[model samples]
Target: MTLRRGACLLMGFALLGGCNLSLPLQGRAPQEVSHRTSSFEPLAEAPQSEILSNLIQRRSVIAEDSALGDVARVALSSGARPSEAKLRTAKLRAEAENKNWLPTIGPVVSLTSLGDVLASLVVDQVLFDHGRKKAEREFAWADVEVAAVTLSQDMNDRVFTALSLYVTALRGQEKAQVGDRAMRQMRAFNRIVAGRVTGGVSNLGDLRMVEDKTQSILSMRDTAKDEATAALAELEAMTGTRFDGQPVAALAGLHDDGGAPLEVLKADAEAKRSVAQATIQRASLLPGLNASGTVSNSGSSATLEASGETGIGLGTGGKLKAIEASKETARRQVAEAQEDAARKQSRLEQRIASQQRQQAEAQRLAQQGQETYRLFQAQFRAGQRSVLEVVNVYEQSVRRALEGVDAKYDVILAQLELARDMGLLADGDAI
Candidate 1:
């Protein structure tokens, strides 16, 4: 019975050992993992600074500038005119017809088939028509303001998008540099291991292990390169130019210390939009005014060849009664636009705040990771820790560093977005 119990215990211990061996390596390998490392050719001697320089130069803060130009051209062609011009035209037209009730004396003329002729001149204008002219002028003015606001909004969007792309590219380039350095370190380690194995100081196993680790690093480097390439491509697409992989200018002293409050910006946009609506409403209540005049002369004689006589008169016409109905519709539309813009601004602010909080947390975690790595490094050098332990700590350090970089980038981007929302972006502030 005693022997059987001992045998059973031994078997159980063996099973447990097998289980541990089969389990995944959750911490680090007993030896460094070896794999093919990614390779990159040296940059060509050609000067590629122009490629990125052109990209920055091509980006525009005012997207609506072009659109506004187009709109202005169309408006001019269609006779929509600026607010000043429209007001002037309306005033002149109103003045010409303001004397509708006034009576005027002039020569009169008439002609008959029996060779009789009569001549006369007459004048007339609107006596009164409520507040038609005033309303029309107000509506025209509102339209002008609406166009200007829309242009400003478009400009803000364009500038923000360009800057976002620029920042992304810059971050990508930094990551690629890190990957390159890692690759170089792995290569050097591989060479050392190879020499040790040849001298019989280390066995084939150690060499193979180092080779595998190198390859893994290479793969990571490849991924980083791809990421950088994609970022550059996106930047190029935005700026409508080629990028030769030049670094973007560092963002320093770019943030505004006195950024306009979100509430203030929202209020301003709403106010301008409201004014546009009011103008439209007011314009609808006004009536149109116009005047016409005609005159003619004829030859006359005592015989059948006598020429006919001519007469002249003046009159004016336009529709003012129906405009008031249209004005009501326009007022409702303006209200809707103002509400929509406010909602968008609110959502943006919330997102930025959330990202900022997350970044702060990440930064704390990274610091902790750094301290832990230092402790592990000291322990490893003293021969009290295995190679695997040291590698695990190094991996942790890399991860923490990446997280910190990402968090920093996120914060910068959020600030940029806020600036854009407030319409504070400028042409010279690319990335």
Candidate 2:
């Protein structure tokens, strides 16, 4: 009977030793994609839209910026954001690590089928950890707040990126328009040169001169087309919105009246979410109670054990002052960030104002040049000017016109950037 009991005990331990008890470490959820939706670029069949109205029709650039930013925010929360899944997983790991603080309990029972069988339940509740366990929980929560701040910053960066691409798309359209106008002027000059060559008034070399200019304009056209395509593709990739036409960025200023400043959003979450949570770590420095008990019965025999632990010894209560200091640092950092953002925003606004002033000057020059071209056209028909002279004025006018277009869009780009910085670039607020 003694040998049988010893064999059973050894076999039970061996079997228990072989039992798999570790956590099921899942392979990191296959590389998280930042794009909220599967990218499918369909065959583009819509007519090319060149007016700013295109932005107004489907969605404003600012609106799209805000929407995509929100989408990315959701992705961050769901472990789908770029590099965010790991951070989110870390928070989960922190919480899982905290489970170690809970007491480990075990059962002490006789392996028998008879009445009055011996049994005991032993529990070790490691409580009153002088704020250690509480601090750990708060720290885990703080990690989540850190993740939120990271996501908000990431979303802020993406908003600027998307808005910049929209501006690029707008500028590309301007280039395409200028290229188109230049090509038309080149064609007219080539026709005049061909007439002179046929009439023996000009040589083949003169005709080739106009043709060379035509070729240069053609190259510019091709370059513009390529750039437009690239900008559209990049926009589509980032925001999942097809850019088939010119992006019209209507002036959308940031009217952030009620929303919290971006700096506050950038702070630790507990501090942002609750005032009491700011002192959470300090509260953790106090000892917490850990209560444990054991009870056993075998026929007429009975036993009981009850005990508890209070935090003591070694570096306890020393870091509470440091934790309090960090809370103050967080607040100061928030204020500094807000001020920096404000300064940057002011710089963009000043630049936009400057661009607007330059746009007006360039438009005036373009108008005067256009009038000169018109008068030169009449003079050529009336034999007061040559085709070559007329073409020179026409080229100069076109250059001025292109300059005006560029200047106008530069202001628009600056305005969009300012709105992005303010974190309120929405579709509905018109310039």
* lDDT of each candidate versus the true structure: 0.47, 0.57
In candidate 2, which residue ranges exceed 4 Å CA deviation? 1-141, 152-167, 197-213, 236-241, 246-249, 260-264, 268-289, 296-327, 425-431
Worst 10 residues of 1 by lDDT: 37-46
Candidate 1: tens digits of C-alpha lDDT, residues 38-93: 11110122123221222123222223344322222222223222433433453354
Tell me the number of clashing residue pairs for each predicted model.
31, 11
- Model 1: residues >4 Å from true position, as ranges? 1-132, 187-220, 233-293, 298-343, 427-431
Q: In candidate 1, residue 261 scores what lDDT? A: 31
Per-residue CA lDDT of candidate 2, range 266-384, in tens? Answer: 45344532333545545544544444444455322212333223244466555656766667776777677767866786788789889989999999999999899999999988989
Positional deviation of residue 123's Cα in model 2 after best superposition, in angstroms: 4.5
TM-score of each: 0.50, 0.61
